[model samples]
Target: MVNVAKAQDETTAAEANTGVAIFAGGCFWCVESDFDHVEGVRETVSGYIGGKSDNPTYKTHTANGDREAVRIVYDPSVVSYDALLRAFFRTVDPTDDGGQFCDRGHSYTTAVYALNEAQAALAEAAKADAAKVLDQPIATEVVSAPTFWPAEEYHQDFHAKNPIRYRYYRNGCGRDKQVEALWGDQARDGIGKK
Candidate 1:
């Protein structure tokens, strides 16, 4: 007979080896959608971070200084954090300090919440490289990771749940076109094969 409990334990152990990276690149829905397509990305959760309030909701987080962010669970062995950083910078306009694309607000600003010293260093280096490549100062900030409050269940995988609305919003926002113009062929390349 199969040892179900042992199998479950093995699965848990395997998942324990994964790493987490959090980022705020404008709307959580769009950020979540973009990371979901990346290889080695196990999962992406839409959430709010860098806030003082406890249990922040979408309606209150922006006012509370929380930014719309995504928690990415990925296999480090398969995809390096550096690669993820490259993909992230390519997906959003790092030069925009006010916000991303059409979204203009504190909550929609781009950020990289580094979970550790190493990640922070990598983020800084990535920011510098991105600025050099674009020949413009990058506005994205690399800050320490904070308590991430997951957004409501309705916000999770929103792109998949509401394809039409997601398409409309994405196209209307001109996210892809802007990214393409910014990063050229490198745009969305982070979603490359595992």
Candidate 2:
């Protein structure tokens, strides 16, 4: 059973001071870029999760059955996990079981990886809220987190390093358009920037 508590009475320094969230919202580039605008998000790392491989990479993660995901490290005092969950749902198409936007594959599917029971509960509630708002069944999975293998250096901070290419890919993939179409005015509600 999930513990469903934000923290244990005894916690490590990092866990006591900050929060970590793992979200798989299709393209890591787009997801990383989206969270960059959030207020308390200190770091976002592009990575792979939900796979059987001991080592996953950009070239082989898909074949290893891993999906693209981002690890968000944020100051919980400034922005709660619930807010991050809301922002995540607004930025991605939760109803698209196939994949997100122009990306269509098993690795592009959306999911929330909860590190603890509390996170799992929040994720489930957020998912339910999103489903209620959309009036449709959401396919996004809210499950326990798995081993999070960070992507190579080149993939890390790809948006800031290669802005034009990132923008081009995001635009070409029609991610923004699709998110807006699905979420409307609430498309980017929790995002600090427009």
- Identify the leading candidate in terms of lDDT: 2
Residue lDDT tens for model 1, 54-129: 8999899988999999988889988888999999998899999999999998899999888777777888999999
Clashing pairs in 2: none
User: What is the TM-score (0 to 1) of candidate 2?
Assistant: 0.92
Predicted structure 1: lDDT? 0.85
Q: What is the TM-score of each predicted model, taking all chains together? A: 0.90, 0.92
Q: Please, what is the whole-model Cα lDDT of each candidate in the order they appear?
A: 0.85, 0.87
lDDT per residue (tens digit) for residues 1-194 in model 2: 34434322212324557888889999998889889899988888899987888779999999998999998888999999999999999999999999999999989999988888878888999999999999999999987776788899999989899999988998999988989999999998898663
Model 1 bad stretches (over 4 Å): 1-14, 192-194
CA shift of 157, model 2, Å: 1.0
lDDT of 2: 0.87
| Candidate 2 C-alpha error for residue 119, in Å | 0.7
